[model samples]
Target chain A: MANKLFDIIKSDLAELETALHESVVSPVATITEIGNHLIKAGGKRLRPAMFFLAARCSENFDLKRVMPLAVALELIHMASLVHDDVLDSAATRRGEATANAKWGNQLAILAGDYLFAKAFVLVTENGYGERVNNQLSRLLADLSAGELIQNKEIYKASCDTEEYYERIAMKTANFLAISCQLGAHVMGLPEKDVQALYDYGYSVGMAFQLTDDLLDLTGDSKTIGKPAGNDILQGIITLPAIRALETSPDKDELLSIVTNRDMTKEDLNRALEIVRATDGIDFTKNKVEEYLDRARNVLPESIPEDVRAAYMMAADFIAGREF
Target chain B: MANKLFDIIKSDLAELETALHESVVSPVATITEIGNHLIKAGGKRLRPAMFFLAARCSENFDLKRVMPLAVALELIHMASLVHDDVLDSAATRRGEATANAKWGNQLAILAGDYLFAKAFVLVTENGYGERVNNQLSRLLADLSAGELIQNKEIYKASCDTEEYYERIAMKTANFLAISCQLGAHVMGLPEKDVQALYDYGYSVGMAFQLTDDLLDLTGDSKTIGKPAGNDILQGIITLPAIRALETSPDKDELLSIVTNRDMTKEDLNRALEIVRATDGIDFTKNKVEEYLDRARNVLPESIPEDVRAAYMMAADFIAGREF
Candidate 1:
């Protein structure tokens, strides 16, 4: 499904790739190297894809005009990830050494700052309007605040579903939602249509994160690009774990494993068993389906059938994605 | 001289304080705490003062119109300093615990990012025009790039005076130049006057940094905030040290101490003595005077005499400042 959707906007993503490569080049060799390292690490480019898909809903979908904004979106995502790796002390991301691991924490911090500044340089160079600028600014604040909040919550067994939702909303959902809304907005869509795109992106984003957390527990290292149960090992209690805490028969043992920073492999295996024995996995899958349904249902009726179908396919692809 | 200049901008500076305090307050307790920690550390507020003084050159100056820009200038400066502390592993700044020291590098990184985003948010809220935005975007890139370059050169005894100048230009001078230009541009000043203000800011910025480097070698910890020879101890080869590398009779000894990251107290003391014996100290002082002269020379004749006097006083203050 993702491959089919990619085929629809394949050329635009290619242009974005070239633009992203060119954007990170700098006089400072270290910055350029780190930027290239991140670029080659390979992401799904979900935000840019969503941006292009939403723009396709409008008649005036000019790639030339919208390319900078799309690039800025991805760069912002990359910058946050670089900083996230530093905060997490993550050695590898997506099966590759992280910038911090490759070039120490100090250089990684500077490289992240460089990427962030470069994002703004691209946007301001294109003279993006106040709405885009304002949204980007707010988005940055939310990204960092969300990370800070998540950092503060690490190892807490009491981490609840509502808190989990708010964290994912700030960290992922709003970013995707804004990506779609901005794409629709710059293509001259009406307010109603823009809001619809936002809603669609939000639903998909929620589903996307739920799937990600699920894979952290269920997927193998080769497929997921990290060790199984990486988040739990890092003391990041996600939705599945939260649900398990509420419903697991062995709740006290699970809670102890979740709270202990030094849990053994046996502890991890047992915690995984406890979560799977309860309704936790099923509850999370249901939630993901519910969000994807909301996404598919929110596609504006005025959009051409082909574009609408593509959006639906995108949502479906997110639902079934393992990595 | 600094006290006299402060008296001139007293009320405006007071307003900027309130705005900066309010700007950093956030719903996240950690962010708010770190932000306030930075605010309480008490920087010189040199960037904002330069901005206000540049704006005062134009009759159209309105404090309300330019207040957000002023707040943003200071925020950018503060944000860079926060990140700088993390990069340097600095324990204290301005006689207070650095964010990294008190909260750890991870939170400090996030706090720095939060401050940076807040600065952009303030600017976008005011909708500053493309030129201002462009300069700011470039300013951020330069700031980070400067740090990266400087970080790369750490403990390299062969580092040259030219490289040192390039680093300071990117890290400090360009930021100051843009601050003055943005202030003048926002006040509807002519291109020539804007350029003049930029030059004035640039010259003073060079002198300011040169003086800072000197203080690190010559002034005691009580007056300079950090201990004397702190820069050398951190393996940061500044201008005076670069000069000593050129002209010191004990050049090999100095180079060995610099290259050896584990230099002892005797090595540091010997290195300091070598630097003081050469033209290193005097050469850097002469360079400071040269830049200050250029700064004073560039004050536009179109400005009122009293405003001109204030700008002169600001430059003079940079020349004589111990901290």
Candidate 2:
């Protein structure tokens, strides 16, 4: 079933590929250079795929309405990735050099700004321009504010779970929620259904990010397509770390290892082992499942069964990805 | 009349002080700590006042229709300031510390992004939402690209006049053009008039920047609110220097003086003398007048007498300003 559904997205994604290149890439300036570089690096077009697939799910969907929005979602995601690379001061993304690494920070920032402006253009060009755009601007604002907040909170060993969730929701989940809501909006769905789709996407995004935190711990560089444990090195405390700190008797013991830069290889191995022995990973996974359950519950009763075929697979893929 | 208009805008600006505070400033992470520090520090809100006043120029106009766009324009201006301070590596703006100076480059970049997002939100919420949005987005992309290009080219004393004009058009003129067009657009004007207003604004904006280039050479810091000869210090070959380089030997002489070190009082005096002795200031002033002439020619024929009052005043203000 997974392979069959993946086959469907591959074909639809091919069509989206043409539009993405044609509409988003411009010869205007070095922006197109940086834009094409980051965009073409081949990250999974997951958000756009959901938007396109979700349109198929709606009984009365408008593909034209959804596709531009789908394009905008991907642009927003790409823009954030550009910014993330800058803030993280990273060199590579998806095994390719980041925009910042290639063009320097100012150019990287301008590239991000270009992509973000392109997003605003694409969404406004689509119908439902007002609602999607205002919300998306607010959404971008929240995302950046969250990043700033995270930067402020970095290396602080005592972040509360609520603050943790707020950070994740703003930085990660909001875009997904916005992506799905925009999809439904473009389909001209009833307001109530739009709200439900937003809820579903929000919960599923939280679940996806929960899994992402787990992936960071357990996944390898080749599998993740980037360096392993980079987030840990950068002092990003994920859900697993928060949970581990909350539940472990050796909380201080683990944090002392995680927080201190003086730790040796043996110390890293011991800390990784201690974190594994704790309930953090399992706890995070269960939390993902809880959100997934909420997402499943909010899905509309009349969603087209054939269209659900693709969405279900996509959701599963998001939840179960190795990277 | 300028004082009366300034008084009017100052009084009305207080009403929007809160909206700007919430919509534009507060969402920035260092809203109170950093953003407000820059915004409230002595810089004039001229662009925003232009928007509000232009929006109120006619019986058909609703100040509300144009106010958000005004705020957006101001935000874009602010964003560029944040970035420009970085590019120029200047430590002061409007006689106070710059965003980069106070918060570092990373924070400056993020703060700029915050303002950009807020600006888009302001425009996205109102009139011809999509069309205006597309125009604004394109303008922003052009502006950022222009800045990047300027950073690269301003170092080259041999850059042609045409290249310099194009850069200034994108970096400085386009937004003011869009702002006027957006102002007319929110008033529900016909398409031709909107385009007319835009072209008029574009030429005027070009004149405006040329005036600024001249002022940077001849104006006082108290009036211009920054150190004089700073542009020469930064290696930016403005129209005066270009004209001087092309038509006289002074530009070559001035170009030789700009160095990696901050200009001393001695260097500034010598450079200023060379610029004047070479007629660089007069050459730029002549170019500014030509642009002003072209700008006045493009104003739409259908505007009400009183409405044209502010527009004409704006053009004069741009053309006549010391900087």
Candidate that would win on DockQ: 1
lDDT against the true structure, per candidate, is 0.88, 0.73
TM-score each candidate: 0.97, 0.89
The true-versus-predicted C-alpha distance at residue A165 of model 1, in Å, is: 1.0
Clash count list over all predictions: 0, 1
Best by lDDT: 1
Quote the lDDT for B45 in model 1.
86
Encode model 1's per-residue lDDT on A41-150: one tens digit a residue: 98889999999988888888899999999999999999999999999889998788999999998899988998888888888889768778778888999999988888
* Off by more than 4 A, model 1: none
TM-score of 2: 0.89
lDDT of 2 by residue, A1-323 (tens): 22567664565677666777766556455766676677678777878776766666666765555667777778888888887788788889888999888888777777787778787777766656677778888888777777776766665654488877887898878877877777777777778877887888888888888888788887877788655455566667887777777778888887887687566667666666777788888888889888888887888777777655566665677667787
Cα miss at A232, model 2 (Å)?
Answer: 3.2
TM-score of the A chain in candidate 1? 0.97
